[model samples]
Target: MILVTGATGHLGAATIHFLLKKMPASQVAALVRDADKAAALTERGVTIRVGHYDDTASLDRAMQGVEKVLLIAGTDEENRVQQHKNVVDAAKKAGVPFIAYTSRTLKDRSTMANLLMEGHFQTEDYIIASGLTYALFRNVLYMDVIPQFVGASVFETGIHLPAGEGKVPFALRDEMGEAMANVLAADSSGSAIYNFTGSEGYSFADVAAVLTDLSGKRVKYTPAEPSVFETQLAGRGVPDVIVQRVIRFLTDIKNGQEDDVYPDLENLLGRKPASLREGLKGLYNLG
Candidate 1:
């Protein structure tokens, strides 16, 4: 049996859908904090287990009779490290043979986006130290973020960011979901780390050009300094910590940390991942 945490979330739900194609629902469990939120999944034959990172008993209950578990990192940025630690501890206690963790693109070295990499690195360290067989799926920035650019273009006619014309390998969330399912289904022999990314890399300017071509509008890429970008986000009511993290992420792109595109995802999926053009079409509602 395989249990997936954060099953009610975007990537988790997608992973469950992909896993269902390869395995029976009885063999898969959706671990969520709220059972009511998972009614749809339950209707689809998934066994729902109420669980939370803070509650070890709940986690233990969810891990009952499960052979493998996918620990989808929690969204709570403040206590994420501890939350991940809790999950790792539970998995160790449950004696699960294989565990899969979702992480970021580059985590070895400190870049401008240290905030984003810190949690991933710490969680990865915890997983390695737990003496459990684990696979790290280090994911790149999602193409789903294109909607932020599209919304800005429609409202402000310009996209402003701290990343100044740097190219980054961006993968679709659906592709990442499929890759995670494939990794979970495979044997846990090597316990390798996979850097999941799309086939092509693109810069902010490249995204602007795609939007211009698709929308027939003059969309411009306006680059700002990290401080200025953070201030702008703060002015818009975003929390200071989150704004700072966003600025740091953009600076990492400017430094080209996310530019490397690897074939790991395609090799696992046995098909080419979605392209920027194809992802944009769905985001912009363009047929």
Candidate 2:
């Protein structure tokens, strides 16, 4: 059986949906912290196992008889490193055959978004050190995060970001989920690391143009220094660490650190992932 942690989350739910197309419900399990939140999945013939990164025994119990496990990275920013370590240790004890982890793109040298990437890198290191057959899905930024570019708050006035005019490859969460499903279902031959990203790269200015076209409103891109951006976010009640990390990511993008587009996702899924324009069309109505 294949077990998916964080099954109630966006990416996890998408992964489970895609996996259902390839495997039977009986062969799938969802490891969640709250079984109540998983009622919909439970009705669909998925086995729900209560577990959390903080609970090693719960994780071990959930992993019982599980052949493949998808360790969806925990969202807790402060305790994420320890949380991932716990999950990895439990997976080791469970003797699961294949362990698939969702990590960040360019983690080995990511100066941008180190707050987010550091946890992913640490988890990747732990997985490699575990000596288990593993597959790492290094995912890029999600198109969903683009929503932050709008609104009356920060970007409502102007597109304020530290990423100058550089383009960065971004992918939708569903695309990453589909690719992850493929990795989880495939045979564990030689372990592999796949960098999952969209087929095209777009800069903040390009995104601003898309938003303007979609909303029929003029939007301007304003690039700021990383320090200024961090101060602005902090003054607006954004946590200092999160603000710092986001600014760093934008700085990296401005420096052309995350500008490459890779076809690893399409090669894995045998199809092209959704494009930015296509993904943004639906959100236009919401905005």
Candidate 3:
């Protein structure tokens, strides 16, 4: 059987949803914290097992008799590495043969500079050292969050960020979930490391042009300084830690950490992933 951790979250749930199309619900299991949130999965005949990353017993129990597991990344950025390690230890103890982890796409020389990259690299290393057969799905930024980053009425407000001339190859979440599902169900003989990304990269300026054309409004990109961006975020009541992390993220993007385009996603899906305009239209209800 296949068990997916954090099954109630966006990526996990979407992955399970796609997995069902390719396999039986009885062949799938969901390790979720909230039983109520998993009613949809339960009703669809998916086995729901309550588990928490911090609770080793829960993870062990959830992994019982599970041959494969999809370990989703935790949201707690500061302590996520420990949480992921806990899951890895349990998976090893449970004798699971294969583990697939959702990791981030990083430059070859990232050096674990930022909080996000640090946690992911730590988790990847721990999983590799765990002596379990594993596959690493290095995912790029999601296109779904672009609308939120750009703002609701972006044509009037403009695209505000610290990134300048850096292009991000962003893939849609559901498409990635589908690709991951394909990976989970396929034979394990294929490449163990998969870099999932959009077919093309887009900068804020390119996004502004797309929004302008789609919304028929004069959208523009405004690059802000790190201090200015942090000040705006703080004035809007964003938490200090989150504000700092956001600044770091924008800085990384500005430094071209997310600029590379990969053809892996297209190869996985056997077609072109959604373009920037297509993602924006679905996200912002633009025509």
Candidate 4:
């Protein structure tokens, strides 16, 4: 059976949605912290196993008889390194033959030190050291988040942020999940690192152009100072922690850190992922 962690999350749920298209629900299991939240999945015949990254015994129990496990990246940012290690160790102890992890794309870890990238880097090392046949899905920024980044009043306020002209190869999160499900259902063990990104990259200027064409509004891209952007978000009542996190990524974008493109996602889906303009149309409700 194949087990998917973080089963209630968007990407994990979508992965199961697509996986069911290829195999029966009897061959599927879900690792969730609370079974109550997985009632919908349970109704669909998916076996729900209570587990947490902090609890090793729970992880071991959840991995029982599981041939492949998708270790969805945990959200406990402060404690995630050790938490991910716990899951990998438990999977190793349980003798699970194959493991797939959802990770992020980091262009350079040597020169630029980022807390987010550091956590993923450490987790990748432990997974490799565990000696299990593994597939690391290094995902990029999601097009789903573009709405959040630009805000609902983007047509009035324009695209205002500190991201500059740096481009991001943003893929749809659901599409990324679809690719993961395809790999998990493969005939052979998935044992390679894959970069899950869009076929092309786009800058904020490109985003503005897309919005203009789709919504009939002349949107503009404005590069602001990080401090100024922080003040603006603060004034808008965005939480401090959330604001800082957004700025961290915006700073990375301004530095051109996440500008690379890859073919792994398209290769897995056997089709071209949605383009930026097309994705924005759906995201902004223009269609």
Sorted by lDDT, highest first, which candidate order results? 4, 3, 1, 2
Ranked by lDDT, the better of candidates 1 and 3 is 3
State the lDDT of candidate 2 residue by residue for 50-128, as single tens digits: 9899988898899899988898888888898898888778878988767889987763463544556677788888999
Score each candidate by Cα lDDT: 0.84, 0.82, 0.88, 0.90
lDDT of model 2, residue 141: 79
Stretches of candidate 2 off by over 4 Å are 107-116, 149-156
Clashing pairs in 2: none
Location of the lowest summed lDDT over 10 successive residues in candidate 2: 107-116
Per-residue lDDT over 13-32 for candidate 4, one digit per residue giving the tens place of the 0 to 100 score: 99999999999999999999
What lDDT tens digits, residue by residue, belong to model 3 across residues 1-287? 99999999999999999999999999999999999999999999999999899999999899999989999999987788999999988889999888999998877545433556778878888888888889898999899988778777687888889988889988999999999999898877633888888988899999999988998999899888889998999999999988888888777878888777888889989999999888889888888
Which window of 10 residues has the lowest lDDT sum in candidate 3? 107-116
lDDT preference between candidates 3 and 4, better one: 4
RMSD of each: 1.7, 2.2, 1.3, 1.3
On lDDT, the stronger of 2 and 4 is 4
TM-scores, each model vs. reference: 0.94, 0.92, 0.96, 0.96
Best by lDDT: 4
Q: Scored by Cα lDDT, where does model 1 land?
A: 0.84
Q: Find the number of clashing residue pairs for candidate 1.
A: 0
Supply the global lDDT for candidate 3. Answer: 0.88
